[model samples]
Target: MAGKRTNSNLAGELLIELRRDDAVPLHRQIEASIRAGVRSGRLPLGSSLPPTRAIAADLGVSRGVIVEAYQQLVAEGYLTSRPGGYTQVAIGPEPAAEPVRTEPKRVPRIDFGYGRADVSSFPRAAWLRSIRRVLTEAPNDRFGYLNGRGVPELHDAIADYLNRVRGTSADPGDVVICNGYAQGVSLLVQVLVRSGAKRLAVEDPSADDDVRPVAVAAGLEVVGIPVDRDGVRVDALDRTDADALVLTPSHQWPTGGVLSAESRAAVLKWAGDRGALVIEDDYDAEYRYDRAPIGAMQGLAPDRVVYAGTASKTLAPGLRLAWLVVPRRLVGDVVQAKVAADRGSPVIDQLTFADFLSRGEFDRHLRRMRPVYRRRRDVLLEALRDRTPGLEPAGIAAGLHLVAWLPDDLSETAVVETAARRGLGVYGVGPYRMSGGGPGGLIFGYSTLSERTITDGIAMLAEVIDEVRAG
Candidate 1:
């Protein structure tokens, strides 16, 4: 009886154990063991239960005991008996495994980290209206899988908007909508590397951090060309064998140098001579405060440039909306890459954004946000000038953030960590560099902070800086 067995493999797998030495009755022990299996998901929904006689014979218990255990489970809804004479598990417990929970770490009260948008200012009423209108009016076909080139309506809207605002020659056919700027870079890098391109040049002390690793992962070498006040040093670019260049020409990130007209022309000339590509990251150009925004370098030579733009700064990063203006020759390959990445972005969001753009709400939102950000930028500049006389803040003329070059002796990490301890959030530009060595500087983003918060955070940051400088 102790060696009793069954032909059922599942019965063998369950290996139900009975404790005869314990105080519990045999029938009760069998019931408890099977019940634990069901609750723990060791017994799956719809799995056949061994026949009562077979189970009783295998466990060396009386057949009536097995029948009673089965009856109890059936009444408890854990097993279902069918008219066809099959008894199976009725309920399956959810898997107990989950990511372990931990205490939330402390966050700085005022975070100056870049790439953050003011979620509170996200024009919710306008967005909701756009969503409703799209849902009400979109054809049934709009919900189906789409071409990788994106929805034609969004392509047309983006083409018109960029042509008017960024001065780029974008034919509607040449635009490919992507999830965001990050995905756009990934797609482009994939295409470029597969096409036999070997090296890419990124501006040092640039916002190229996110894109560089993507390119390198695709088996291409990324070189760092130093950027000066006028933008990426083209004179130095001539020395590297880089086959493509990713630049923030309109407003250099972290550095804020608008690629000079001279530098812009030089880079294009360099590309043309080498038959190379220039990726123009036209990020945050719409927010320039001191002058009329510089026209996108893509406008100068669209055939040689790939223009990238995003709503991350203009609207919200949560929107995950961005577009690329590819040269006609590269459109097909870029579209293919996009399709393979995710079969294009979500269609409903694309349609909603198209509606938003067509209704002029996108432009209106930008207009409303410009003054608010400009005032904050002004406050930041003035505060830095008044309290931190030794630090020089540059890139203030444009973009949501600027870089303040610290004194040579002060380390960027020391100031950043001290500021965090004081409940202020800010970052150093050192991580953005491709190489270890660069100027000692800190980057501060003002788009998400209010005027009062900016003033207070800067005051606290100044004290931290003074402490770093003193010690």
Candidate 2:
């Protein structure tokens, strides 16, 4: 009888084919199959192949043929192996084309970008301690899916902290944790739109450009009210037919003005009379150097005002943690929206932050950073006073940044461009305005810069202003 014919099939679903009658040797044929699989994207990079013994037994060939084929592919840079590890595909597929920019971006030597905190002071040790405690003490179920409103521990912690620090009458049941201020606003806007709100009003010349796009995308008409030294003008707000208003009462953006007491009362009254809602974005309320920060407006009328606060200013923006104290009637709607936006914010982070707040670590970190930021603000003001007397810094009593009025002779765009050419980063206020009638100015954020760096950047800015004026 003829000898038993050898099987031709390979195993482990590697998508390899063998030709028994071809003149080429079995080892070379196996190598070609693997090469074709890799080149045609069938075998992805970093994917492991079957063992030599398994493939040899399936193909009814000697193990040496399989070993030689793998060795050859390895030598050609298509496979990688170690003493005990499985061989894997080593080469990457061809790259796709990427879009090109008309002008290359320049990395500035002294950057004064706004909306950033001193990330170098993040209190990593305290955070690590909190995380360790959670892992050791928390129940196993804590790692699973959580309530959209947030965990009870974080809700209680945020409520207690806000009541004591921000003067808000927040109940744990009414607090909804969100990704950040951006998501907080987006969720609330969706709720408002669903409730038949047609128009929303915001501060003109506001630094927070994020709110407009979110509101518009959700099908709400956004109206702009002018802002002055006392914050958003109540007169302009009274004139609009807006069903809801969002403003930074404690420390306004870009302009850096605190809403006057009379105006705050008037705003609450306006909301009550019109049967509307007010969103109090209490961002950057912890760094007031002149005196104690003002209590949140939400304290006066909890049912009519929505209190929004975030860790981005006090801790770090990368945390993406924030809270909204909703009215009792609106809590359910907002939580439903939160569930739809994302199941909820990360639970581990929420628990870690709750532990951080409960142990008083959050308060201690803020106390340490308050003076550091205050000193940076003073140094920036002093440098501007000495180097560029023509520039006047406003809204310096609070927040991480302030706006300086540029002289009438120098154009805002011209000064910003000329400063960029000198390796300095400065932003103009005109772009933040809804309608253009205000004086030209530049916004300087000093929270992330050292005192020495602030001085040097101001000196460079002064020279750039002079050059622009001469031309």
Candidate 3:
């Protein structure tokens, strides 16, 4: 019934006038008018035309004439109709610009880049069950904007889990749930800047690629300390005037070096003496392949160290759940920062995670994943050892990846490029390095790839290395 108008009003809106003297049939004139309307944008896409009976009465023609014209336009792709739905303009007469075709790039067969987890193993069934339980039993108050710190249940769960598992001195009040480690770092940087802090130090070869840029954005200068076989060089701490330092002591990222007891103690003593803060990023602490991994550094001096952990490593990163064990003194400022930043993370996810943790489901998931990841790590290390004797693979003790240090003759770029040509993807730590240069190395992540794929990929890489050597 659209455009239900008198004879005079119909001509301006639909712009259709039967040309009897021109020898054109009435149906053809109607069809031509509609076609012109579509091309001129008069009847834009999704616009409904008048019903057949209404238009036929206005034009003093039979309804079959209008129907025939509409049917022809529909067949020509200018109109569309659905079952029990309105007949609307389907497309413009002139089609959209077609994208130009170019040569398609080939995808790599095997990738060993860092920061990837075995997401295929995500606990979908268990998570769904937990979500169902939360939805069915959670109180009405749980969904409201009750706390800026996070859901109390999640706060308690995270604090208790950290104290018991990571050996950190955490209390429910001192925990703050964040979107992820990225937001946690940003919030910490903001809080530190407000406290008159100006400079920060990070490990030279850590896997955390965002901390330096985040710190610089907050107007803090970053100084990279060199990492040796025994973790960071603590003796060099006296040389720089850093307000704080971020350390991955449990299992140092990329380099795979554990902070020796001497360096650990030295760093703590230096922090205490210099009145500096230490942010301990417990990245991938749960997947330690060897014997039990080292405890968190925050346990040594809770007042001076801020412990940060995320579910992104254990669970899927898409979950966006992370927690920080703030010192009692800094709790107020940290919570204020969280309030300014998104208020708080989603409540339902927090509650579901709380339920997941309280039921010991998280522990079970980690236990199931450890052995699987260990086997993959072992396979990667064994293959690299047999195939590429020149490349030395280190840091196989813990975490998801191992660092293969290339000989001085082979650059990181050469190994990576040669491997790519053979359908293998490998990463270099050069991007992670700061001004202080470190030995060239490739980081191999094996958390997601299968054993057969790992073996074949490493074999192919061996062939590529041989070709590189031959040339």
Candidate 4:
């Protein structure tokens, strides 16, 4: 049995006896066994652990039981994750392997770093049909550079949708299309900074470490405004002459609380009082689980709020489609920023997406993804409550992933180390810091994962946690 897995004597199989005791939690016990497997190298370097479903099926236990166990392992640094799957022994017990090859940077298995649209359930078939019809009626040899400001029809369609749906004071003329939110973010920042707004206030708990740097690179000073449970505390605005602020008023990233009406009004009033501007990231706006989405803040104060959003969350990030709704006065400046940056995006993408949204396929896509994400959210909740001990997930109602705060004694580094050992792509929320301690937690993205994967993945995570707790 040199390199073969012998179920009876192997560490991965020792869990059968551990499960016999009903008093002990199955996940922790399973975790202990997995740890033994790693230490002994019965699960050799770069080896794959049975996924949660496989483990659950073998143990005749619920997948949630497995999810809890895996969560512990992820916390313990016994797993490393990849997109679509994770590897158990990829990181290995030691730096024992010799260099066998050289490679470019490995794309992360699960990219929790970037906020993405849950497009797994997008109405692709319907979208394809629309594209087919449009293409069929098109002129021959039709592949040419598109209109500079996006197709007229798509702009009109997006205008109608935004005004009706999000309640922004946007006409087709007011909207400037770009490749995605990042581009929109950069363009808007340049316009304001170029307009003499030197400093911009932002939330500490935010997704755009990129945006802040992007702003700086575009020649604006970045300032932090702490976010309260109700949203960015308006009172915390940097006490300077800064004239612009960036916020996700609808669903704040990472923490996932909507701006309270009081807070929302306060921010608007601040903008008005200071004659400042607001950069609104309407991120993950459509997928609300526990409550209806609070209407976009742009609706409340049209002149001061510069609304920005993208199809990255609702459709696929690959579409690279997003919009910036600047005040009528800022349009020329922002469009110029766009023109300078990339001479406008591929005209065809704008045409296709505008057609996609206008025909109502985009809305249909959102509706389809809502229930799927809701189910995944529920599964995550149930997994944590029933299986994950000492772990808590906040921001439950919306967004693709939930943030799980680790216990006070848990080391973020250890959690990361344990996850690497197991091939689980777990990340600490504050690990992205240029400076400062963030809430010690993992941002578990559940959108791209199937239920079984979520169940299994969480089980892997639970295992790391159990190992750490025992230590």
Candidate with the greatest lDDT versus the true structure? 2
Off by over 4 Å in 4: 1-114, 118-120, 137-148, 238-240, 432-435
Q: Taking the tens digit of each residue's C-alpha lDDT, what string does model 4 give over 136-240?
A: 755443356543456666679888898888877777888888888888888888778777878877887777665888888877878777775567767777354
Per residue, candidate 1 scores C-alpha lDDT tens digits across 1-471 of 242232365677556788889898877887888888889887877778788888888889889998898889899999888665767878988667899999888899988878666778999999999999989999999889999988998999999999998899999999999999999999999999889999989999777757877988899998999888768898999887888999988788778887888888989999999999999988888887888878988888999999999998899998899999999999999999999999999998998999899889999998998999999899988888887777889888888998899888889999998988898888988888777877788898998888888888889988998887788
Q: Model 4, poorest ten-residue lDDT window?
A: 1-10
For residues 250-297, write the lDDT of model 3, one tens digit per residue.
Answer: 778878888877788889998999899999999788888776668888
Go through the candidates in order and give each one's C-alpha lDDT.
0.87, 0.90, 0.86, 0.75
TM accuracy, model 3: 0.80
Q: Candidate 1: which stretches are off by over 4 Å?
A: 1-104
- lDDT score of residue 446 within candidate 4: 79
lDDT score for residue 219 of model 3: 94
Per-residue lDDT of 200 in model 4:
77
Which order, best to worst by TM-score? 2, 1, 3, 4
Clashing pairs in 3: none
